[model samples]
Target: MSLPDRKEAEVRRMLDVPHPAVPPDLAARAAERGRRILVRRRAVQAVAWALLLAAVAAFAVWAAVVEPWVVPPADTTPPLDGW
Candidate 1:
């Protein structure tokens, strides 16, 4: 047989072989690992949200104390004061 035919035969042989069975405990182990990862992710997200809320509160307090929304009066240099 030619090279192509030989490669096809090899691939067919490989495909015909049965795959190995999974270990009985593998599913349980995978579920436990997934839960651990999920917990860590949620904890990190919670911390990030708390920090954001803290920053917003601090800004609000500072704004209330400073009254930044009020506009300052215009300065005309005291007309005729130096005359």
Candidate 2:
């Protein structure tokens, strides 16, 4: 037949096949692995947040001390034309 018919027949064959028996501890092992992955992800996120906060705090302290936004007034010496 055509490609669609062949694809339908293949899907039907796949559905007709019996599923394999799963191991009893498979769910428990998967749950444990998921917990570990979650813990690691949370820890990494926490570290990233802490580092970002530290950088912000340091920048704030530096800005407070330096006052980088303000410019100093210029001083000009008297003219020495009579010398």
Question: Which candidate number has the best lDDT?
Answer: 2
- Report the Cα RMSD per candidate: 3.8, 2.7
Tens digits of per-residue lDDT for model 2, 33-78: 9999999999999999999999999999999999999996668777
Worst 10 residues of 1 by lDDT: 74-83
lDDT of model 1 at position 19: 87
Q: After aligning candidate 2 to the native by TM-score, how far in Å is the CA of 3 from where it should be?
A: 2.0
- Summed backbone clashes in each candidate are 0, 0
Error of 2 at 74 (Å): 3.6
- How far residue 75's Cα lies from its native spot in candidate 2, in Å, is 7.2
What's the TM-score of every candidate structure? 0.67, 0.77
The lDDT for every candidate, in the order shown, is 0.96, 0.97
Write one digit per residue (lDDT tens) for candidate 1, span 2-83: 9999999999999999989989999999999999999999999999999999999999999999989999788766567656
In angstroms, what RMSD does candidate 2 have relative to the true structure? 2.7
